[model samples]
Target: MNQDTTMHPRDLLRQMFLAAVEAAQPARGVPPYLPPAPKGRLVVVGAGKASAAMAQAVEKNWPGPLEGLVVTRYGYAVPCAHVEIVEAAHPLPDAAGLAAAERILERVSGLTADDTVLCLISGGGSALLPLPLPGVTLGDKQAVNRALLKSGATISEINCVRRHLSAIKGGRLAAACYPAKVLTLLISDVPGDNPCDIASGPTVADPTTCADALAIVRRYEIELPQSLREILESGRGESIKPEDPRLAACTTRIIATPRMALEAAAEVAAKAGVTPYILGDAIEGEARDVGKVMAGIALHVVQHGQPFATPCVLLSGGETSVTVRGNGRGGRNVEFLLSLGVVLDGAPRIHAMAGDTDGVDGLEEVAGALLAPDTLARAWAKGIKPMDALQNNDGHGFFGALNDAVITGPTLTNVNDFRAIVILDPARD
Candidate 1:
């Protein structure tokens, strides 16, 4: 569905987010990338928030029989008759994930050249398929993951560490399917849509090494378990290199990405008669900093119209990081909106929305939050200081107080964050 000009600006913003999400749905993105059925048995195995949905899509479209297992974050699973959907913890590994990883490895092992292994990957797979190397336990991996998340390391850095520590990631999963042709269908959730960064490149070859992972851990000052540190220093948990012959037959395809989602949202805005200008789809860095920069861009667009004229919508996608320094609920999207509001200070004739396509921002069930020109004025009316809220990293509380937080439960798919700022012509308003 397209945006409706008659709809409220907030409603239009939400419709744009939903349209972006719909474009990344597994059913919509998977079919065109599906390959010809293999002559031998088809074994499907995957791990991520979207893997279960992707598997279901595969089953619905496949002409032949398929058997497999996929693990997804809790509450993100969809029913699939042939493929078993195992729900597990996300952003962190659990016992279930470890067991599923073992089973998945076993499922693809000993495959013949005639057999085909289909690996459906997406965001969160790194945590959903954590199999630690020998001498390391799941708790150790969990500790590292927790530290990395809180350390404000980019997803690439975080996944680099994960790839080294994981037994299934970093092309090891593809190596296990050694003589078999492994086809990996990915829903890209990382900036630049790098195949190796998505789910830590379980099925694709990894060019990083143990030393690189160690450098990232050191750079972030992430305290790793002594044994884990030893493993890294000793080069024991090194990932499969790009020259590995076992990965020669493996093919990776990105079927969905943040750019695709942003483009879809742009189409909705265009349909509603709003010119959509995509800033960039690979934006990164601190959430608050990005918000401030976006505010400047919006102001420039509204005043000078050099970048674009008013009555236009600015669109961007990509994951932003939040370095939490307070004891408040932290969500990158909400934090971004809050910081943007602080800069706007009730600017005239502008509205914006920021949300994660996965439907959850940070640890909260809220997707993100909305921003109106008078956002700060309304917050002041409620005795809520936007600057203080931003400092506390309490975007959830700030937006919740105004009843402006966007909540969408679990979207069952992830393509990173979506942001849109609509600038209305003051004269028209």
Candidate 2:
């Protein structure tokens, strides 16, 4: 698609975000990395927000017969004739996920060395494949997940706990496959794209220990169910280790990542006659704090051109955390954008957009929101206090009132969060 010079800056920013998401689509990202057809039966299974779409991509590209099951977040499923698509809760586990996890484990249990088990994994897989260890109940896992999410812990910390509590995660699934050749295809949504951290490494070996999981829980002061505490304390729920013989035949490959998405957006910016500066694809921190830092960078670019000249777009991709201290709607992308708007404070010829690549930000349906030079002015006109909204973690509400929210219903793939700030030369316009 050609860049229309007449397109509004907000529209341009949104276009870049869309291009990033499109680049990470399972159909486009999965096929290139798919392993060759196995000698024996191909049994596919996976859990994540993108697993269903990944399954569909696999089926569309595979030449041989394939039958499998994949569980995705509710409403994230894409129709697949060969692989069964199961819908489940995400960022939280449900009975549906538990059942699906059990069935998936059963499906791969008796495979031989010649057989191939294709494991499709992505972000949100940890919560989507919550099969509690023998002593821990589903409720226990759910309680810990809620605590970890609210406690301001990073994704790695949260997944560390999930790895230990789960019966199927942290390479146990690969172990269950025994001598089968397990090929795990990942669409990384984590900051570092660590295969062991994605989807809690269901089909890959985990190097972390139950001790590490316990430490994270203690560091965050997350109260766990008594049964879960016992499991961790006794080391009963420790995940499969890196040197475990059971995982000897398993392999993992990342087909899509946050960096790839950012590169796509950078290309879009370049096509629009804007120099694209990719700051980093693995930036991580509190949403508001990261926004402030990004704003400083944008200002530096505008005033000094130390980093780069004007008529450029600054791009970054990573998962930022939101420590919810308010009752307002909380989405990390919107939080970052709102904080950015406040920092810019009506800076001329500057615009920005931040959104989750999955098309859902926090618990809201909206992907994220856009920010213009007049964003603060518009909010003031509407009698909405920007600081008050920011304090309340209500970026969604603030952006919604101004009708600036970017809504893209489920992109069917995830590569974490995407943010872009366009700095244009006022003289050029």
Candidate 3:
């Protein structure tokens, strides 16, 4: 659907936000897609910020006995009576994550062809399930994770490196349940929601080569453990490929994705009486650079009304990166907003907002931030420099100072980034 030809700009913006959030709800897609109970045993396993809720959704609706384990980001866990839900660190591996990974691997053992394994995959599962390869400790994986998170590497690039170093990721988990029928239901947080990229594609076949993983590491300059370096160099731990016969019985389903959520937002925009232009759902690059480009487009709409007329809204979804330099918080959405604020310089009639659909930008509690016509002018009046904030990677503080931070704590599901640029007509004197 296209933008709304009939609603207010603010109303359109709000509706867009609501649509993105609605598309990610666990209850919306996770329940009805479940496979029939296994004749032998139905074992559930998953990892992500939404795993806990996904687990609960399974427990509430399943007609047969359900037993298993799943891990989620700390503070994101929801209660479930049957399955054990473990909380662990995210974006970085920790000891708790290691423990959970070990337990998960153990759960998949001894599965027969009659058994069914339901795997719930979502964003943040990469770090939530960390079981390092031989001779590499959890600390080694943590260091690499910290480096990658700060390196501005894309999600696909980061996961390539991660797949090589873990025992559970990169199709190993699926291999463990060899004879069983594995059904994977995923909530995509990556740009394209490629099954192999989500949670490192534990239950799906991997077509990525070990050399591919090595190239990504070198591209990102991510420091790796001596053993990890050898593991990739030797190319001994290659994951199951697309043609691997062992995975013939496996099935993967993407319940939600960035594109779907973007479409939902577009529908909301149409309902709100505003014209919406969807640039693309797979955008990538440094957050600040993208913001500047978006600012250029927004300015065009206001000045020439060429690509889109005034009273139009620009919308997009996808994950953006941030190369962390400063010690301050670095949510990609906030970084984008701060950069846009500088480029826009509080231009008359142009306002924008960039936010993570998961409701947490980077590691900050705030979902993202917003900007209005006077954002930059107001910051300059208070002696706050937008460029300085960008340099310090303190987008949160920069937006917080202007009281423009969008704070929505723990919205649960993650589809990726939701960005909107609202353009309106100039006021009459």
The CA lDDT of each predicted structure is 0.91, 0.90, 0.85
Q: Each model's TM-score?
A: 0.97, 0.97, 0.95
TM-score for model 2?
0.97
lDDT of 3 by residue, 125-222 (tens): 99999998887888888898888889999999988888877788888898888899999999999987788888888888888888999998898788
Cα RMSD to native, each candidate?
1.8, 1.8, 2.4
Clashing pairs in 1: none
Q: What C-alpha lDDT does candidate 2 achieve relative to the native structure? A: 0.90
Task: Give the candidates in order of lDDT, highest first.
Answer: 1, 2, 3
Model 3 pairs in collision: 3-276, 4-269, 4-270, 6-273, 7-272, 7-273
Worst 10 residues of 3 by lDDT: 1-10
Give the lDDT of residue 255 in candidate 2: 91
Candidate 1: how large is its RMSD?
1.8
In model 1, which regions exceed 4 Å deviation? 1-5
TM-score of 1: 0.97
User: What would the C-alpha RMSD of candidate 3 be, to one decimal place?
Assistant: 2.4
Clashes of each: 0, 0, 6
Tens-digit lDDT track for model 1 on 327-393? 7798899999999989988888789999999988988888999999888999999999889999998
* Candidate 2 lDDT, 367-410, residue by residue in tens: 99999888999899999999999999999999999999989898
The 10 consecutive residues of candidate 1 with the worst lDDT sum are 1-10
